[model samples]
Target: MFPFKMSEGNPNDGPTPQPANPTSPCPCRDDTKGTQRYETKEQEADSAQESCYSLFTVTQKRWIVFLVAAAGMFSPMSSFIYYPAINSIASGLNTSVELINLTITSYMAVSGVVPTVVGNAADGLGRRPIYILTMLIYLVANIGLALQNSFPALLVLRMVQSAGSSGTISLGYGVISDITTPAERGSYVGLLLLGPNVAPPLGPIVGGVVSSKLGKLLDSDYASVARTHGLEVNRVFGDDLRNFPIEKARLRSVFYIIMGASLSILAYGWLLCFHVHFSAPLVMQFIIGATSTAIFTILGALLTDINSSASSTAAASANVIRCALAATGLAVVETMVQKIGPGWCFTIFSGITAAMGPLLLLERERGLGWRNKIYQGNGGSG
Candidate 1:
């Protein structure tokens, strides 16, 4: 029933605005008040603007950017962590330090080369599976290194390890592109720069401890056996068994330690594959691998997202070129360090890598200008 009846001579046949009400039933609402409709074009536009603004809120956008940048850091962390252990590894295996250094060089070479080839594969194959597989490969390689006695085997395994590990770093950028807008991309890009820059100092410190302390522990039993033999004590365990008794126990203990370490690595790898949760230090190297992989993946995704939303193909191509140039410069620096000494090389290269942080800051400032222009042009069209 109508709340108000129209008089026969009412001027209500023409369009008339409804009276504003404090608590009256809205004309926009149905009887149940479960649904409402926008009656004017202005109302629809206002609703859409609010939604867009909500979606691009400063806090949400900053986190998305942060995650992407964190992802990019993994690659450099994973790559640099093993450099300090090269000389110790060489001594343990009775090989020359130069030969061990080649393994490091080869690993770097593989990392640099594999990403270019796999970058396309990642776009086609998707991100999660490739990342899991790469982590597994890295886990296996570390296990192999711990167990292996031969230099050739180590070399080949290092290559395989690097091939798998490097793919995630490259694919991460692409994933970021899928998620972020162009105007917001530079912050994410800056995060990617943090990975390589921050890793060098951290990597070497860990590497130094592992190589020095662990290496000494590993060789202690052998050193003890040599000393005992000079004192006319039997190094051999028993008359029946040909092996040294104390040495055998030490070897068994070594095997147990290696086995424990290997299992920890495997467990983390499985966790990564199955998306299980884990803590660090308990798993040590695996934790490093996971953290590094995750960081790189996140940053890559942010970069990709920004590029996809905001950049033309030409602009994206320019970014790639810039990345390549930076890599080339790094290579030249690395070569100089190899010729001089690692200490000087690392110091200089570390400085260069650190400089990336400031570069990212500058780029982020520039990106804001570009973002405004794009938004203005889009607004003008609308």
Candidate 2:
């Protein structure tokens, strides 16, 4: 009798099986998903430990993403920051308004075209190096633009500026993907996008103020100086402060900011609901805008950290998605408000914003666990 009972007609009934050959590929092992097969559990554990130990901590990674988001802001802000200077530029260059307007066209064209090339380069060459190169190009272009005397110089320099600034947002997205995981990506992505969103409305206001304060410098020196200062500031934080814990440093401020934002949004909604003073709610609107701006920047950076392998393309895809959603939201918001009344409209939005809080927290917890697993080989380690 067989030591081990074998059922009649079973696959093993024909013969006693020999032990699996450790030197040969296991026939029973299905590797369709590309998971590496180790000879033993000990080998797998050692591999995981090595992989985890090489990665940067969550804090360090976030700081890098934050800098990328800051750099990314220059592109969208540049789009509208020049609006107040159009007429000034026309007069300064002794050119027609129509001719000067073509500068905008050229800038927009370069902005769209440059990102694809830069993003691809970033994917292949690495994020930090590509960012520095682009920024340098943008700085040089800005200086030339400030010194320009004719419409041709203005047009050419603007294109150069666009080429330099356009790819930054893409690079920021790539950096985010490098450090973050898919589970917590949404909130981080939302944070990173804040700059572009905030810039649109504030751009004109800032441009008008800057133009008024520095009328002579508007087309002569202000743009170059401002660009230079921004670059210097970014370099300090991005490069000089590389050793600081990024996620911890940045996120510590977020709780208070979010709390204040939530209260302001709620107050704004309540004021509208009760038909109270309009001006108070308007002030609250500004507060909400300011707080939300920071929130979005944080979220955007967090989103990209989850998927590092194809970060550049992911960033590009995200920008397209953001544009589409924003367009759709704008299209429907007015209709929704008209039907529901301003108070209810705001209340609905407030609820939506509030809902994001828990989701963010959940992602944060998951992200921390994921980071620990990646860097520590297990969640049990501190």
lDDT of each: 0.50, 0.62
lDDT of candidate 2 vs native?
A: 0.62
TM value for model 2: 0.48
- Which segments of model 1 are wrong by more than 4 Å? 1-74, 202-382
What TM-score against the true fold does each predicted structure earn?
0.43, 0.48
lDDT tens readout by residue for model 2, 1-382? 3334344577756665444553666556678234444446668777666654226665776576567667877887787889888898899878888888788777766766677688778888998899889999989998998787887788888899999998888887776566654323434455455444545676333332332222222112212433443523221112221222223322444566677677788788778778888888878877786666556445444334433555786566555565556556666779877898767776777777777777666664465555556656644332
TM-score of structure candidate 1: 0.43
Model 1 Cα shift for residue 323 (angstroms) = 10
Q: Model 1, range 256-339, lDDT digits (tens) per residue?
A: 333343444444444444444455433555434333333232233333433443222322343355446656766685576458
Candidate 2: which stretches are off by over 4 Å? 1-46, 197-308, 317-382
Candidate 2 C-alpha error for residue 33, in Å: 34
